[model samples]
Target: DSIRVGDSLTSADRPVSEPISTPPLAPPTLSCLFGANNGPLVGQEGSIVTSSKIRARLISETDNNVTLTVESCIEDAEKTLVFGRGELQLGILIEQMRREGYEIIISPPAVVTNICPDTGKKTEPYEEVVVDVDAEYSGSVIDSLTGARKGVLVEMMDDASDGKTRLLFEIPSRGLLGFHSDIATVTRGTAVVHHCYLDDREYAGALGSKLERGKLVSCELGKATLFALASIAERGTLFVEPGDMVYPGMIIGEYNKVTGGDLEVNPVRAKATTNIRTVLKEEKAYLPPPKRLTVEELIGYMNDDEIIEVTPKSVRLRKVELDSGARERAARVKKKRLQAQMQKKK
Candidate 1:
């Protein structure tokens, strides 16, 4: 007789067959999940708008998907770890979640590491990096990767068609930070980089240093005028145009000259007007457009002492030590500490 769990089954006039038993399905090993953020874009695009809804959807996903598992982590309130194939696979999941109208806070993608219990030693994940780029770009890629202290080039192959080269390296997770932008700039958007996990290994030395230059800061808050930018642009590249919002301590752009110590210029002040007017028409002013930094660029460009402020609508780069006086004080203290450590080693 066929019977449902909740309903009663009655016997018919004809003989009934015995019920058949089935084995339970095993749970899935793979899982895909997302995290939360306080960005303004949340709740704007999807049916599951609330955080709770998002959470529920994730939990419900494991119901029929026997191979997958979902659970919350103990460390962070706003984070969830979804173990899956690799970063590329996880990246696809993140894109889907975002398209569904969920605002998320994604830390730069990293591989989960483990410790060897017997040796009590730390180990990290690594990847095989394959880069194909123009011959000119090969040097910059090598320099950049080596600077990051991430990987070593294993081989190089020449591409005869366009005078390009293919380079391979074994890179650590930390070293790959911000490599995307660097590759784009070096190859002029012609390089192709592919990477996947290789194996666990001992920690590599410190990755390359952060940006060496200081920001072009603004001293006041107001609309930027052409005259103000003209003067400031002489110091370095300008990040703002005339009539743009200016705030004190805001980084306007990067400087072109490396020798000049950190320079800060006010962009809000207007040009002075003259009382006496000439008969000839006033000369027109032309200003160059400023370079805008995206989230990835801001992250890649920031120094260890800085943090990238990410909001739904905007991304701003600010010093970790917000106050100028405080930042100077911290730098001095850090310098003294490093000097003391060096002396101790001697």
Candidate 2:
């Protein structure tokens, strides 16, 4: 309450109210951080992918951008945590960084958890999402939110004349990660989504994993050859084309179904040159162009062992280990560790 410009108010024996100080502006807690992009192609595309350069760049980001903050990891200086408003804001930063010729590896969006001051319990962020979809897509949207995302249905209203529906949901923040792509898929690009911070609540169990099919990883490094890609394409879809540059542990394509799992194939293998010529005409192989992923999509599709290699000239996906044998060994080690943990729990 404030006094009028020309009027003065006086009180006798007034009880003083407790002083309320404005809270200092705190940095946003990172939903995920971009890890080191230390792939084989690290320095080729960007001039600033090193620890020092990345740190400098990230620190500078906070100067102009109010939605995000940067901090170095105590365990590894090469890795930095970038706290931001959400994936969309972070994705824009990644794109800008790449354009500036910085090569980096981005990690999947990490879920942020906090300690509730009052209850002394772990808390996680939640969101209020509102979606408008065509009548035909309304059911699927509801199912995805309530079933897969653990969202609470707040309200649903149908527009009979226009054949569209308005839906509201209170969903865990982590559940909304990568959901824009799914919403596009389900609604045939006819849906609109708006979300804002709701509140923090006790942490929930796992919402679920990305529903993407397994990817095709390359086993060799070189320019892909039509002779080799044609053979590999039969197993599933091809993401790389002939003459495309590929490296060991690079993701080349995706399997047709989720059950197919990951498979390693040679993207650079070429047919042996021989003196013998075929008597009959050979059919020319036609291969589809490789899939191009946006910064958000790339981050969304990446697995734990994978990272997005961002460079000014190129964007690639590669395994952390790089070598096929090393990756397999790492996978085995991880599996054993998980099994041990499970046994301990039991």
**In candidate 1, which residue pairs clash?**
28-66, 28-67, 28-68, 148-208
Give stretches of model 2 more than 4 Å off.
1-30, 209-212
Compared with the true structure, model 1 gives a TM-score of: 0.66
RMSD of each: 8.6, 6.3
Give the clash count for model 2. 3
**Over 4 Å off, model 1:** 1-114, 161-164, 208-211, 257-261, 279-284
The candidate that wins on lDDT is: 2
Candidate 1 C-alpha error for residue 193, in Å: 1.3
Model 2 lDDT per residue over 1-346, tens place: 2332233344557744553344444335345556656776667666776767777888877767656768777777668888886778788998998888788887767877889999999988888999999989999899888886889999999999999899999988878777888889999999999988777888877876546688889988789999899888887877678877888889988877676668988888777778888888877887777677777876666777887787888777777777777777887998899999999999
Worst 10 residues of 2 by lDDT: 1-10
lDDT of 2 at 342: 100
Candidate 2's TM-score reads 0.88
lDDT of each: 0.63, 0.79
What local lDDT score does residue 276 receive in model 1, on the 0 to 100 scale? 89
Question: What's the alpha carbon RMSD for model 2?
Answer: 6.3
| Candidate 1 structure quality by residue, lDDT tens digits, 148-263 | 55688899999888898999999876576567877898778999998766776776656666546667877676778888888788777776788766565567777776645456
